[model samples]
Target: MFIRIVKMSFHEEKIPLFLDNFHSVKNDIRNFPGNNFLELYQDKNNPSIFFTYSVWNEESDLETYRNSDLFKSVWAYTKAFFNDKPQAWSVDKLESLP
Candidate 1:
């Protein structure tokens, strides 16, 4: 499995816009080809900071999604609210506790 995590920092005043945008597009992302999971998280101390966690069947699947129009539109809307450049990591699972 391919695990992808992205950290985003949004402008405080634009947080609501970000949330609305996410709410509208999240389902499309979760249903995208080769997507297995999707999740969102927020920082305890910094409400403006958020993270997206997702799993895909493979790296190529992720690349295909990233190049899709759904991603293009979603990213265009999302990036407008960013307060800082996003950070991301793609990783492979080595083990599971259970």
Candidate 2:
């Protein structure tokens, strides 16, 4: 599996709006085809900064999602609140332990 991590920094005043929107569509994203996991994290020292962590069966799956209407609409809404350009990375899982 591959992991996708996205770091986003939003305007302080827009955080609540972003959170509400995320809550509304998170399930749909998590259940999207080829997606195995989804999570959100916030920076303790920087309230405006957040990260999205997700796992996908393949890179193509992520690409497909990126091109979907769901992603387009969600990203358009989310992008408007950004304080800075978002950053993302895709990497392979080297190991995991239960």
Question: In terms of lDDT, which candidate is strongest?
Answer: 2
Error of 2 at 63 (Å): 0.5
Q: Taking the tens digit of each residue's C-alpha lDDT, what string does model 1 give over 2-94?
A: 999999999999999999889989999999999999999999999999999999999999999999999999999899999899999998999
Predicted candidate 1, C-alpha RMSD = 0.8
Q: Which ranges of candidate 1 are over 4 A from the true structure?
A: none
Tens-digit per-residue lDDT, 6-35, candidate 2: 999999999999999999999999999999
RMSD values for the candidates in order, in angstroms, are 0.8, 0.6
Once fitted onto the true fold, the runs of candidate 2 whose alpha carbons sit more than 4 angstroms away are: none
Whose TM-score is greatest here? 2
What's the TM-score of each model vs. the native? 0.96, 0.98
